[model samples]
Target: MLEMAKIVVQKTGEQIPVMYNPTELSLNKTVVLLGQGSNIQFQRVEDDDLTVSLFFDTYEQQIDVRTKTDKIAALTQPTVGTADRREPPVVVFTWAGPLFTGMISKLDQKFTMFLRSGIPVRAELSVTFKRVLTPEEDQHDQGKFNCRQLWLVRENDRLYMIAQKTLGSPDQWRLIAQTNGIYNVLDFPTREDVGRTLVIIDTHGETFNEVGNV
Candidate 1:
């Protein structure tokens, strides 16, 4: 059986349980790609974003729509009255040992059913979360690099720009293309390459050489 997923708010240390676990969860990730006439270039991928739809109701339940909405709002809101002035609460959704950590980027609620007095009795919340990586996590990921690094295409990213950024020179762009098996030397990269992961070879501090020469 799948374990229930719970959202944990770091600021208030509150754990909000979903009344009915989301039947479907959507995760979105994309790479940056640019379009040129008749050609495509691969770029870098963006961070993962998560979206989940939650249902809340008072049908034979003690918590009403108003109360449940209020609790969720608190988890999504920024903390107040602190001298440090921190960002909005960091939320973690954990289920079956896998976890996603992020801040609530969007919260949309709809009241579906109402009581005779017009009070809301049932609601649905569609929440979107943008992923956040801590410095330690980023460092750990970097440490895992070996002879090759994986790069995700981002918007406005080009092979030369990525080469310069990663290997310290735009002149080494061909190395990237060669490593990724991109043989189209006649045209520039296009939007089709966006969201693609490209393998980047580490030159080991050596100068670029033709694949035939090596």
Candidate 2:
């Protein structure tokens, strides 16, 4: 069976299921451009937007279709009392898996069917979701964690021994030596060096060899 699509409110964790699956979905992105013609260049990749059309039908149950559409529409309003939330709520539009994670940026409702009293029985909704990444993801995408850290030297710790303990290979010790200015391996980390520390680079590559290279 085809699974129904749903919108999940990230703040309140409310799952608002769509009555009918959208016939089509669109994902669009715009790039940041600079200069013109011969001097033109791309500055960066800009944000993306996900657009979907949803349909609702409550004619058989004789209820207002707004009861369903209202939930999605309310996502456009800023949360009251939440001083930090000046914009609409962030939500996940999902089916099979997450299709998009964003905030509802635009919404247009069209009444297609109504009862004798003008109560909407069926409606179509056009929704636009603006893309945004969480702070952790944004930082990761920006390579903020490709940094070095400190490793304290313990008693009786040699370079190869430290390498084995910290980097999982005894032979990969030259990386540690070269990165920390430990050219005099024989004269380093003796009993007098028991309480020293070294800067451990959080990277490894084809450039790093297994031995004597330090």
Candidate 3:
């Protein structure tokens, strides 16, 4: 059987499964032009954007389709007391494998069907996601060649759990914390840590394991 496409919240391990898989996807990127005509060159690439249409149907269940699309819309809202930053939660869109890891940049919802009481029974959602890269990666053009395997932090990740996954031992969490300079060793993977890149390097600067980027 074929699997359904879904958006996973990197903060709370919540899985928002779409009613149907996407039939098509659109990807785009921007390039910067530098220098004069002869010396003109592609300066840098920015904003890897992914767009997909999701469909939600609650007709058989006799429920409002907004109940599903609202979850996707919430991802574009800022967290409490963070109005100044306007940073929404990051999410990963996955189907059979990882597709993209980014925050929801644009969301457009259209209700196509309704019940007798005017309750929406079907909705079409157009979601656009902007790819996020680590600061180290963003400065690659500045002679920064330091690249290593990194684990993309996901929802509900604990220090011990990460150590076990990467280093093959739960007791190595302290070593990981020390290597990463994390003071809060006990409560790791804070909300701020989610959707971030994590490197599993030992004190000797040897990598253990990490997931590949999409």
Candidate 4:
């Protein structure tokens, strides 16, 4: 009555189904400290990561180790030329519905149970993915230009880290500082500024109506 989970490689446009669905899936959310005190701050959703463990067997399923290895390797391989700075191919993990869309962040494989000829008959693969939010999706919530979000400073909380967690990329930290009128880099939020608030301006550089304190 349920469909098995499958990983689709967009570059090759090939879908590889696992022999057995993973028993568990792990998801993580990012949280920042509001100050040196006991208070904790909740930020916007960061990139969503997914991990899937798969088992490959040749003795029982007629699928050889090489076949499985090649399939997994293809998922991790770079799709574009070296001269191009674009990232590797995007991977989609789907089951009954689309689960995640992103690139493979890590892949671990192990081979065990070899035949007398030294051929591996059984193998295992552990894959992890980092979610990439598209522009449309990034601005989807109340529209980026009109959405207002605030984050409280924490001990050792840097603009870059905050940007990475909130904007999905650390490179956007300058925009955060600029939007908040933080001209002096030395005045950047530190433990002393823990109770201070910083405005999260989206990529469009538009100012939204400010919400209450965090």
Model 4 residue runs over 4 Å out of place are 31-43, 61-63, 140-146, 149-203, 206-214
As for model 1, its CA RMSD to the true structure in angstroms is: 12.0
Clash tally, candidates in order = 15, 0, 0, 0
Candidate 1 wrongly placed segments (more than 4 Å) = 11-13, 33-45, 80-84, 139-214
Rank order (by TM-score, best first): 2, 3, 4, 1
Q: Please give each candidate's TM-score.
A: 0.57, 0.61, 0.61, 0.59
Q: Which ten residues in a row have the lowest lDDT in candidate 3?
A: 205-214
Candidate 3 vs candidate 4: which has greater TM-score?
3
Cα deviation of 110, candidate 3, in Å: 0.7
RMSD (Å) per prediction: 12.0, 10.7, 16.6, 11.6
User: What lDDT would each prediction earn against the true structure?
Assistant: 0.74, 0.81, 0.77, 0.73
* The 10-residue segment with the lowest total lDDT in model 2: 205-214
Clashes of 1: 15
Error of 2 at 197 (Å): 27
TM-score for candidate 2, please give it: 0.61
Which 10 residues in a row give candidate 1 its minimum summed lDDT?
138-147
* TM-score-better candidate, 1 vs 4: 4
